[model samples]
Target: MLLVLVFSLLATCSTAEEKAPADSTPLRLTDVSTAEAFINSAEVVVVGFFKADEGNGFKEFLAAIEEVKTLPAALCSVKEVWTNYSINSDTITIFRKADLHQENLQLSKIKKLDSDGLVRFLTINDIRYITEYNQASAVGLFQSKVKVHLLLFANRGSTDYKPLKERLGALAPRYSGKMLFVLINGKEKANERALGYFNLKSSDLPRVGIYDGESDKTWLMAPGEISIERVQNFCDSFVTGELQKEKQAGESEAKNEL
Candidate 1:
Protein backbone atom coordinates (compact mmCIF):
# COMPACT_ATOMS: atom_id res chain seq x y z
CA MET A 1 0.00 0.00 0.00
CA LEU A 2 2.86 2.45 0.80
CA LEU A 3 4.63 1.65 -2.45
CA VAL A 4 1.42 2.17 -4.45
CA LEU A 5 0.80 5.59 -2.78
CA VAL A 6 4.33 6.78 -3.58
CA PHE A 7 4.03 5.62 -7.21
CA SER A 8 0.66 7.44 -7.61
CA LEU A 9 2.14 10.72 -6.20
CA LEU A 10 5.08 10.57 -8.63
CA ALA A 11 2.78 9.93 -11.57
CA THR A 12 0.58 12.89 -10.65
CA CYS A 13 3.58 15.23 -10.37
CA SER A 14 4.94 14.11 -13.74
CA THR A 15 1.58 14.64 -15.45
CA ALA A 16 1.25 18.14 -13.97
CA GLU A 17 4.70 19.08 -15.14
CA GLU A 18 3.97 17.84 -18.64
CA LYS A 19 0.68 19.73 -18.89
CA ALA A 20 1.90 23.08 -17.56
CA PRO A 21 2.66 25.86 -20.05
CA ALA A 22 6.36 26.37 -20.66
CA ASP A 23 8.02 29.71 -19.96
CA SER A 24 8.35 31.96 -23.02
CA THR A 25 11.79 31.83 -24.59
CA PRO A 26 13.88 34.95 -24.35
CA LEU A 27 15.01 36.53 -27.64
CA ARG A 28 18.46 35.38 -28.74
CA LEU A 29 20.67 38.45 -28.75
CA THR A 30 23.16 36.85 -31.11
CA ASP A 31 20.45 35.98 -33.60
CA VAL A 32 19.27 39.57 -33.59
CA SER A 33 22.80 40.79 -34.33
CA THR A 34 23.28 38.28 -37.13
CA ALA A 35 19.92 39.14 -38.66
CA GLU A 36 20.76 42.83 -38.53
CA ALA A 37 23.98 42.16 -40.38
CA PHE A 38 22.09 40.13 -42.99
CA ILE A 39 19.53 42.88 -43.45
CA ASN A 40 22.09 45.62 -43.88
CA SER A 41 23.32 43.80 -46.97
CA ALA A 42 20.00 43.74 -48.79
CA GLU A 43 18.46 46.58 -50.78
CA VAL A 44 15.15 46.25 -48.96
CA VAL A 45 14.74 45.02 -45.40
CA VAL A 46 11.42 44.96 -43.57
CA VAL A 47 11.71 44.07 -39.87
CA GLY A 48 8.75 42.69 -38.02
CA PHE A 49 9.33 42.02 -34.33
CA PHE A 50 6.51 42.20 -31.83
CA LYS A 51 5.78 40.89 -28.36
CA ALA A 52 3.79 37.66 -28.34
CA ASP A 53 1.12 39.41 -26.31
CA GLU A 54 0.89 42.34 -28.73
CA GLY A 55 0.90 39.99 -31.70
CA ASN A 56 -1.87 37.84 -30.25
CA GLY A 57 -4.32 40.73 -30.37
CA PHE A 58 -3.42 41.67 -33.96
CA LYS A 59 -3.62 39.06 -36.67
CA GLU A 60 -2.64 41.59 -39.34
CA PHE A 61 1.02 41.80 -38.36
CA LEU A 62 2.09 39.50 -41.17
CA ALA A 63 -0.02 41.36 -43.71
CA ALA A 64 1.39 44.67 -42.55
CA ILE A 65 4.89 43.28 -42.99
CA GLU A 66 4.22 42.00 -46.51
CA GLU A 67 3.10 45.47 -47.51
CA VAL A 68 6.38 47.09 -46.47
CA LYS A 69 8.59 44.66 -48.43
CA THR A 70 7.80 46.61 -51.59
CA LEU A 71 9.99 49.52 -50.48
CA PRO A 72 13.74 50.05 -50.74
CA ALA A 73 15.88 49.80 -47.65
CA ALA A 74 19.11 47.93 -46.98
CA LEU A 75 17.75 45.93 -44.06
CA CYS A 76 14.66 45.11 -42.07
CA SER A 77 14.64 43.64 -38.51
CA VAL A 78 11.58 41.82 -37.30
CA LYS A 79 12.22 40.03 -34.05
CA GLU A 80 11.04 40.71 -30.53
CA VAL A 81 13.24 42.26 -27.92
CA TRP A 82 13.51 40.05 -24.81
CA THR A 83 11.01 37.68 -26.40
CA ASN A 84 10.73 35.32 -29.35
CA TYR A 85 8.72 36.11 -32.49
CA SER A 86 6.84 33.55 -34.55
CA ILE A 87 8.58 34.08 -37.87
CA ASN A 88 8.47 31.62 -40.73
CA SER A 89 9.46 31.25 -44.39
CA ASP A 90 6.43 33.22 -45.58
CA THR A 91 6.81 36.02 -43.05
CA ILE A 92 7.68 39.49 -44.39
CA THR A 93 9.51 41.28 -41.64
CA ILE A 94 10.68 44.88 -41.95
CA PHE A 95 13.41 46.22 -39.70
CA ARG A 96 12.15 47.73 -36.48
CA LYS A 97 14.31 50.35 -34.71
CA ALA A 98 13.02 49.33 -31.27
CA ASP A 99 14.43 45.79 -31.45
CA LEU A 100 17.80 47.12 -32.68
CA HIS A 101 18.11 49.42 -29.69
CA GLN A 102 17.14 46.65 -27.29
CA GLU A 103 20.39 44.84 -28.05
CA ASN A 104 22.32 47.76 -26.50
CA LEU A 105 24.64 47.62 -29.50
CA GLN A 106 25.47 50.83 -31.25
CA LEU A 107 25.08 50.75 -35.03
CA SER A 108 28.74 50.90 -35.97
CA LYS A 109 28.03 50.94 -39.68
CA ILE A 110 25.23 50.29 -42.19
CA LYS A 111 26.57 48.91 -45.45
CA LYS A 112 24.31 49.59 -48.41
CA LEU A 113 25.00 47.26 -51.30
CA ASP A 114 24.55 47.89 -54.97
CA SER A 115 23.21 45.27 -57.38
CA ASP A 116 26.70 43.85 -57.79
CA GLY A 117 27.17 43.51 -53.99
CA LEU A 118 29.58 46.42 -53.57
CA VAL A 119 28.99 47.89 -50.10
CA ARG A 120 28.89 51.48 -48.87
CA PHE A 121 28.00 52.74 -45.42
CA LEU A 122 24.80 54.70 -45.01
CA THR A 123 26.02 56.60 -41.98
CA ILE A 124 24.56 59.52 -40.01
CA ASN A 125 27.32 61.75 -41.30
CA ASP A 126 26.63 60.53 -44.84
CA ILE A 127 22.93 61.28 -44.45
CA ARG A 128 23.71 64.75 -43.12
CA TYR A 129 26.07 65.40 -46.00
CA ILE A 130 23.49 64.26 -48.55
CA THR A 131 20.80 66.38 -46.92
CA GLU A 132 23.01 69.46 -46.83
CA TYR A 133 24.02 68.97 -50.45
CA ASN A 134 20.43 68.49 -51.54
CA GLN A 135 19.39 71.61 -49.67
CA ALA A 136 22.18 73.67 -51.21
CA SER A 137 21.19 72.40 -54.62
CA ALA A 138 17.76 73.93 -53.93
CA VAL A 139 16.46 70.49 -54.67
CA GLY A 140 13.17 71.21 -52.97
CA LEU A 141 12.71 74.70 -54.34
CA PHE A 142 13.36 73.77 -57.96
CA GLN A 143 10.42 72.93 -60.21
CA SER A 144 11.07 69.23 -60.57
CA LYS A 145 9.89 68.04 -63.96
CA VAL A 146 8.97 65.46 -61.34
CA LYS A 147 5.92 65.63 -59.14
CA VAL A 148 6.83 66.10 -55.49
CA HIS A 149 4.50 64.49 -52.99
CA LEU A 150 4.15 65.40 -49.34
CA LEU A 151 2.24 63.50 -46.68
CA LEU A 152 1.57 65.77 -43.75
CA PHE A 153 0.08 64.16 -40.64
CA ALA A 154 -0.06 64.16 -36.86
CA ASN A 155 1.36 61.04 -35.15
CA ARG A 156 -0.07 61.71 -31.66
CA GLY A 157 -3.49 60.06 -31.64
CA SER A 158 -3.62 57.16 -34.05
CA THR A 159 -2.79 53.52 -33.52
CA ASP A 160 -2.59 53.18 -37.31
CA TYR A 161 0.11 55.82 -37.66
CA LYS A 162 3.00 53.36 -37.43
CA PRO A 163 1.66 51.05 -40.11
CA LEU A 164 0.85 54.05 -42.24
CA LYS A 165 4.33 55.45 -41.83
CA GLU A 166 5.83 52.10 -42.71
CA ARG A 167 3.72 51.86 -45.82
CA LEU A 168 4.64 55.37 -46.89
CA GLY A 169 8.28 54.75 -46.14
CA ALA A 170 8.30 51.81 -48.53
CA LEU A 171 7.34 54.19 -51.33
CA ALA A 172 10.51 56.25 -50.83
CA PRO A 173 12.54 54.84 -53.71
CA ARG A 174 9.71 55.34 -56.16
CA TYR A 175 9.80 59.03 -55.40
CA SER A 176 13.57 59.32 -55.45
CA GLY A 177 14.89 62.57 -57.01
CA LYS A 178 11.32 63.79 -56.74
CA MET A 179 10.67 65.93 -53.66
CA LEU A 180 9.08 63.97 -50.79
CA PHE A 181 8.66 65.07 -47.22
CA VAL A 182 6.70 63.51 -44.37
CA LEU A 183 5.57 66.44 -42.27
CA ILE A 184 5.11 65.00 -38.81
CA ASN A 185 3.00 67.55 -36.99
CA GLY A 186 3.96 66.43 -33.50
CA LYS A 187 4.50 69.93 -32.14
CA GLU A 188 2.00 72.78 -31.96
CA LYS A 189 4.51 75.34 -33.14
CA ALA A 190 5.75 73.15 -35.99
CA ASN A 191 2.20 72.25 -37.00
CA GLU A 192 1.22 75.91 -37.01
CA ARG A 193 4.22 76.80 -39.15
CA ALA A 194 3.40 74.03 -41.61
CA LEU A 195 -0.22 75.15 -41.74
CA GLY A 196 0.75 78.76 -42.33
CA TYR A 197 3.34 77.87 -44.99
CA PHE A 198 0.96 75.59 -46.87
CA ASN A 199 -2.12 77.79 -46.23
CA LEU A 200 -3.87 74.76 -44.85
CA LYS A 201 -7.11 75.08 -42.96
CA SER A 202 -8.29 73.00 -39.98
CA SER A 203 -10.36 70.92 -42.38
CA ASP A 204 -7.17 69.43 -43.75
CA LEU A 205 -6.42 67.13 -40.83
CA PRO A 206 -4.51 64.75 -43.10
CA ARG A 207 -3.50 65.93 -46.52
CA VAL A 208 -1.43 64.67 -49.45
CA GLY A 209 -0.24 67.42 -51.72
CA ILE A 210 1.55 67.16 -55.06
CA TYR A 211 3.90 69.93 -56.04
CA ASP A 212 5.15 70.62 -59.55
CA GLY A 213 8.85 71.08 -58.86
CA GLU A 214 9.58 72.96 -62.10
CA SER A 215 6.46 75.12 -61.88
CA ASP A 216 6.77 75.90 -58.19
CA LYS A 217 3.00 75.28 -57.81
CA THR A 218 1.18 72.70 -55.73
CA TRP A 219 -2.01 70.80 -56.36
CA LEU A 220 -4.18 68.81 -53.97
CA MET A 221 -3.31 65.35 -55.28
CA ALA A 222 -5.61 63.83 -52.71
CA PRO A 223 -6.62 65.60 -49.53
CA GLY A 224 -7.15 62.45 -47.48
CA GLU A 225 -6.33 59.76 -50.01
CA ILE A 226 -3.10 57.84 -49.62
CA SER A 227 -3.09 56.48 -53.14
CA ILE A 228 0.43 55.49 -54.14
CA GLU A 229 -0.50 54.86 -57.76
CA ARG A 230 -2.08 58.26 -58.23
CA VAL A 231 0.96 59.97 -56.76
CA GLN A 232 3.26 57.90 -58.95
CA ASN A 233 1.32 58.80 -62.07
CA PHE A 234 1.36 62.44 -61.10
CA CYS A 235 5.14 62.26 -60.75
CA ASP A 236 5.53 60.35 -64.02
CA SER A 237 3.68 63.02 -65.92
CA PHE A 238 6.12 65.65 -64.68
CA VAL A 239 9.03 63.49 -65.71
CA THR A 240 7.46 63.15 -69.16
CA GLY A 241 7.28 66.91 -69.71
CA GLU A 242 3.68 67.54 -68.76
CA LEU A 243 4.99 70.34 -66.54
CA GLN A 244 7.93 71.48 -68.71
CA LYS A 245 6.77 75.08 -69.16
CA GLU A 246 6.39 75.59 -65.42
CA LYS A 247 9.78 74.02 -64.76
CA GLN A 248 11.51 76.14 -67.39
CA ALA A 249 9.98 79.33 -65.99
CA GLY A 250 11.19 78.49 -62.46
CA GLU A 251 14.66 77.58 -63.71
CA SER A 252 14.87 80.86 -65.60
CA GLU A 253 14.08 82.82 -62.46
CA ALA A 254 16.63 80.84 -60.48
CA LYS A 255 19.33 81.44 -63.11
CA ASN A 256 18.62 85.20 -63.08
CA GLU A 257 19.43 85.31 -59.34
CA LEU A 258 22.89 83.95 -60.12
Candidate 2:
Protein backbone atom coordinates (compact mmCIF):
# COMPACT_ATOMS: atom_id res chain seq x y z
CA MET A 1 0.00 0.00 0.00
CA LEU A 2 2.81 2.40 0.88
CA LEU A 3 4.70 1.73 -2.32
CA VAL A 4 1.57 2.16 -4.44
CA LEU A 5 0.72 5.37 -2.64
CA VAL A 6 4.17 6.82 -3.20
CA PHE A 7 4.07 6.06 -6.92
CA SER A 8 0.59 7.58 -7.30
CA LEU A 9 1.64 10.75 -5.45
CA LEU A 10 4.78 11.12 -7.54
CA ALA A 11 2.69 10.89 -10.70
CA THR A 12 0.24 13.56 -9.52
CA CYS A 13 3.02 15.97 -8.53
CA SER A 14 4.78 15.46 -11.86
CA THR A 15 1.63 16.22 -13.86
CA ALA A 16 0.82 19.29 -11.75
CA GLU A 17 4.27 20.83 -12.19
CA GLU A 18 4.22 20.59 -15.98
CA LYS A 19 1.25 22.92 -16.21
CA ALA A 20 2.23 25.18 -13.29
CA PRO A 21 1.74 28.90 -13.70
CA ALA A 22 4.82 31.14 -13.95
CA ASP A 23 3.65 33.84 -11.58
CA SER A 24 3.17 31.47 -8.63
CA THR A 25 6.32 31.40 -6.52
CA PRO A 26 6.39 28.85 -3.69
CA LEU A 27 9.27 29.18 -1.24
CA ARG A 28 11.53 26.15 -1.08
CA LEU A 29 12.58 24.90 2.35
CA THR A 30 16.01 23.26 2.65
CA ASP A 31 15.82 21.60 6.07
CA VAL A 32 14.07 21.33 9.42
CA SER A 33 15.57 24.61 10.65
CA THR A 34 14.36 26.59 7.65
CA ALA A 35 10.92 25.01 7.84
CA GLU A 36 10.52 25.87 11.53
CA ALA A 37 11.86 29.37 11.07
CA PHE A 38 9.60 30.11 8.14
CA ILE A 39 6.49 28.64 9.72
CA ASN A 40 7.03 30.47 13.00
CA SER A 41 7.64 33.79 11.32
CA ALA A 42 4.63 33.76 9.04
CA GLU A 43 1.31 34.73 10.61
CA VAL A 44 -0.28 32.14 8.32
CA VAL A 45 1.29 29.89 5.67
CA VAL A 46 0.32 26.97 3.47
CA VAL A 47 3.07 24.33 3.63
CA GLY A 48 3.25 21.28 1.42
CA PHE A 49 5.64 18.39 0.99
CA PHE A 50 6.50 16.89 -2.39
CA LYS A 51 9.04 14.41 -3.74
CA ALA A 52 12.32 15.91 -4.90
CA ASP A 53 11.54 15.23 -8.56
CA GLU A 54 7.74 15.81 -8.43
CA GLY A 55 6.14 19.24 -7.82
CA ASN A 56 2.92 19.68 -9.81
CA GLY A 57 0.75 19.64 -6.70
CA PHE A 58 2.60 22.61 -5.27
CA LYS A 59 2.07 24.59 -8.47
CA GLU A 60 -1.68 24.02 -8.55
CA PHE A 61 -1.88 24.78 -4.84
CA LEU A 62 0.01 28.03 -5.29
CA ALA A 63 -2.14 29.21 -8.16
CA ALA A 64 -5.27 28.71 -6.09
CA ILE A 65 -3.69 30.29 -3.02
CA GLU A 66 -2.54 33.41 -4.87
CA GLU A 67 -6.09 34.49 -5.60
CA VAL A 68 -6.56 35.31 -1.92
CA LYS A 69 -5.34 38.84 -1.10
CA THR A 70 -4.81 38.55 2.65
CA LEU A 71 -1.33 39.43 3.93
CA PRO A 72 1.02 37.65 6.39
CA ALA A 73 0.37 34.50 4.39
CA ALA A 74 2.63 32.50 2.06
CA LEU A 75 3.13 29.15 0.31
CA CYS A 76 6.02 26.79 1.02
CA SER A 77 7.08 23.60 -0.71
CA VAL A 78 9.42 21.25 1.12
CA LYS A 79 11.23 18.13 -0.05
CA GLU A 80 13.64 15.47 1.30
CA VAL A 81 12.35 15.51 4.90
CA TRP A 82 9.18 13.42 4.85
CA THR A 83 10.78 10.46 6.63
CA ASN A 84 12.11 12.77 9.33
CA TYR A 85 8.60 14.08 9.99
CA SER A 86 6.65 10.84 9.25
CA ILE A 87 4.77 12.68 6.54
CA ASN A 88 3.85 10.31 3.74
CA SER A 89 2.80 11.40 0.29
CA ASP A 90 2.32 15.04 -0.69
CA THR A 91 0.47 16.82 2.06
CA ILE A 92 -0.76 20.37 2.38
CA THR A 93 -0.65 21.88 5.88
CA ILE A 94 -1.72 25.21 7.25
CA PHE A 95 0.40 26.77 10.00
CA ARG A 96 -1.09 29.70 11.85
CA LYS A 97 0.75 31.99 14.24
CA ALA A 98 3.39 29.85 15.99
CA ASP A 99 1.55 26.53 16.15
CA LEU A 100 3.05 23.68 14.14
CA HIS A 101 0.15 21.27 14.72
CA GLN A 102 -2.99 22.91 13.42
CA GLU A 103 -4.01 19.39 12.37
CA ASN A 104 -7.54 20.10 11.21
CA LEU A 105 -6.04 21.75 8.11
CA GLN A 106 -3.52 19.12 7.02
CA LEU A 107 -4.66 17.60 3.73
CA SER A 108 -3.12 14.56 2.06
CA LYS A 109 -3.93 12.15 -0.74
CA ILE A 110 -5.38 15.11 -2.57
CA LYS A 111 -7.26 14.43 -5.76
CA LYS A 112 -6.80 16.65 -8.80
CA LEU A 113 -8.14 20.16 -8.29
CA ASP A 114 -9.10 23.13 -10.40
CA SER A 115 -8.54 26.68 -9.17
CA ASP A 116 -12.18 27.20 -8.22
CA GLY A 117 -12.58 24.05 -6.10
CA LEU A 118 -9.45 24.78 -4.12
CA VAL A 119 -10.32 28.45 -3.57
CA ARG A 120 -13.85 27.57 -2.51
CA PHE A 121 -12.61 25.03 0.03
CA LEU A 122 -10.25 27.52 1.61
CA THR A 123 -12.90 30.25 1.77
CA ILE A 124 -15.61 28.01 3.23
CA ASN A 125 -13.34 26.49 5.86
CA ASP A 126 -12.05 29.97 6.74
CA ILE A 127 -8.47 28.99 5.99
CA ARG A 128 -8.17 32.66 5.07
CA TYR A 129 -8.51 33.33 8.85
CA ILE A 130 -11.95 34.68 9.74
CA THR A 131 -12.16 34.23 13.50
CA GLU A 132 -14.95 32.30 15.25
CA TYR A 133 -16.53 34.14 18.16
CA ASN A 134 -17.72 32.82 21.55
CA GLN A 135 -17.39 33.88 25.20
CA ALA A 136 -13.73 32.93 25.35
CA SER A 137 -13.05 34.74 22.08
CA ALA A 138 -14.22 38.13 23.30
CA VAL A 139 -10.95 39.10 24.96
CA GLY A 140 -8.91 38.26 21.91
CA LEU A 141 -11.18 40.21 19.63
CA PHE A 142 -11.13 43.12 22.02
CA GLN A 143 -7.35 43.17 21.96
CA SER A 144 -7.13 42.86 18.19
CA LYS A 145 -5.40 45.70 16.38
CA VAL A 146 -7.99 45.52 13.64
CA LYS A 147 -11.59 46.52 14.30
CA VAL A 148 -14.01 43.60 14.67
CA HIS A 149 -17.42 43.11 13.10
CA LEU A 150 -19.10 40.25 14.92
CA LEU A 151 -22.04 38.36 13.40
CA LEU A 152 -24.20 37.09 16.24
CA PHE A 153 -26.40 34.09 15.67
CA ALA A 154 -28.65 31.71 17.64
CA ASN A 155 -26.36 28.78 16.97
CA ARG A 156 -24.00 27.50 14.31
CA GLY A 157 -26.00 24.33 13.69
CA SER A 158 -29.27 26.10 13.00
CA THR A 159 -30.42 26.79 9.43
CA ASP A 160 -31.58 30.22 10.51
CA TYR A 161 -28.02 31.53 10.36
CA LYS A 162 -27.45 30.57 6.73
CA PRO A 163 -28.54 33.83 5.15
CA LEU A 164 -26.48 36.01 7.49
CA LYS A 165 -23.44 33.75 7.28
CA GLU A 166 -23.55 33.77 3.49
CA ARG A 167 -23.79 37.54 3.50
CA LEU A 168 -20.82 37.96 5.85
CA GLY A 169 -18.71 35.41 4.01
CA ALA A 170 -18.90 37.60 0.92
CA LEU A 171 -17.63 40.63 2.80
CA ALA A 172 -14.88 38.76 4.67
CA PRO A 173 -12.57 38.69 1.66
CA ARG A 174 -13.18 42.32 0.82
CA TYR A 175 -12.36 43.48 4.37
CA SER A 176 -9.74 40.79 4.95
CA GLY A 177 -6.71 42.88 5.79
CA LYS A 178 -8.54 45.96 7.04
CA MET A 179 -10.79 44.38 9.69
CA LEU A 180 -11.62 41.14 11.46
CA PHE A 181 -14.95 39.38 10.90
CA VAL A 182 -16.04 37.17 13.80
CA LEU A 183 -18.98 34.74 14.12
CA ILE A 184 -20.51 34.50 17.59
CA ASN A 185 -23.07 32.03 18.89
CA GLY A 186 -25.50 34.10 20.91
CA LYS A 187 -27.34 31.21 22.56
CA GLU A 188 -24.33 29.28 23.83
CA LYS A 189 -23.39 29.35 27.50
CA ALA A 190 -19.83 30.14 26.52
CA ASN A 191 -21.08 33.44 25.18
CA GLU A 192 -22.97 34.55 28.27
CA ARG A 193 -20.38 37.09 29.30
CA ALA A 194 -20.03 38.47 25.80
CA LEU A 195 -23.79 38.86 25.50
CA GLY A 196 -23.90 40.70 28.79
CA TYR A 197 -21.03 42.95 27.81
CA PHE A 198 -22.89 43.85 24.65
CA ASN A 199 -26.28 44.14 26.43
CA LEU A 200 -27.82 41.51 24.15
CA LYS A 201 -30.38 38.79 24.79
CA SER A 202 -31.89 35.79 23.03
CA SER A 203 -34.73 37.97 21.78
CA ASP A 204 -32.24 40.07 19.89
CA LEU A 205 -30.77 36.99 18.24
CA PRO A 206 -29.18 37.08 14.78
CA ARG A 207 -27.68 40.53 14.82
CA VAL A 208 -24.49 42.42 14.03
CA GLY A 209 -22.17 44.36 16.27
CA ILE A 210 -19.03 46.35 15.68
CA TYR A 211 -16.22 46.56 18.19
CA ASP A 212 -13.69 49.32 17.76
CA GLY A 213 -10.64 47.87 19.47
CA GLU A 214 -8.84 51.19 19.42
CA SER A 215 -11.59 52.95 21.32
CA ASP A 216 -12.84 49.94 23.30
CA LYS A 217 -16.42 50.86 22.35
CA THR A 218 -19.01 48.64 20.67
CA TRP A 219 -22.22 49.44 18.79
CA LEU A 220 -25.15 47.19 17.94
CA MET A 221 -27.26 47.28 14.79
CA ALA A 222 -30.77 48.77 15.11
CA PRO A 223 -32.37 47.11 12.11
CA GLY A 224 -34.69 44.26 13.16
CA GLU A 225 -33.71 42.17 10.19
CA ILE A 226 -30.34 41.42 8.60
CA SER A 227 -29.49 41.78 4.92
CA ILE A 228 -26.28 42.26 2.95
CA GLU A 229 -27.10 45.83 2.07
CA ARG A 230 -28.11 46.72 5.62
CA VAL A 231 -24.99 45.19 7.13
CA GLN A 232 -22.82 46.90 4.51
CA ASN A 233 -24.48 50.23 5.25
CA PHE A 234 -23.96 49.68 8.99
CA CYS A 235 -20.30 48.99 8.43
CA ASP A 236 -20.04 52.05 6.20
CA SER A 237 -21.77 54.26 8.71
CA PHE A 238 -19.50 53.05 11.51
CA VAL A 239 -16.43 53.66 9.42
CA THR A 240 -17.59 57.11 8.46
CA GLY A 241 -18.63 58.03 12.04
CA GLU A 242 -22.12 58.80 10.74
CA LEU A 243 -23.98 56.29 12.93
CA GLN A 244 -25.84 57.64 15.96
CA LYS A 245 -24.40 56.99 19.43
CA GLU A 246 -27.65 56.71 21.38
CA LYS A 247 -29.49 53.39 21.53
CA GLN A 248 -32.86 52.66 23.19
CA ALA A 249 -32.35 50.45 26.24
CA GLY A 250 -33.87 47.03 25.84
CA GLU A 251 -34.93 44.31 28.29
CA SER A 252 -32.37 41.90 26.86
CA GLU A 253 -30.42 42.38 30.06
CA ALA A 254 -31.14 40.41 33.24
CA LYS A 255 -31.81 42.90 36.01
CA ASN A 256 -29.52 41.27 38.56
CA GLU A 257 -26.63 41.36 36.13
CA LEU A 258 -27.19 44.98 35.23
* Local accuracy of candidate 1 as per-residue lDDT tens digits, 56-106: 312343333233223223222344422343443222233322112111112
Q: Name the lDDT of candidate 1.
A: 0.36
Q: Against the correct fold, how does model 1 do in TM-score?
A: 0.36
- Candidates in order, TM-scores: namely 0.36, 0.47
**Candidate 2 lDDT, 47-105, residue by residue in tens:** 65655434655565666668743422344344444555566666655554411234223
The per-model lDDT (C-alpha) reads 0.36, 0.52
lDDT, residue 76, model 1? 25
- Name the top lDDT candidate: 2
**Candidate 2 positional error at 172, Å:** 2.1
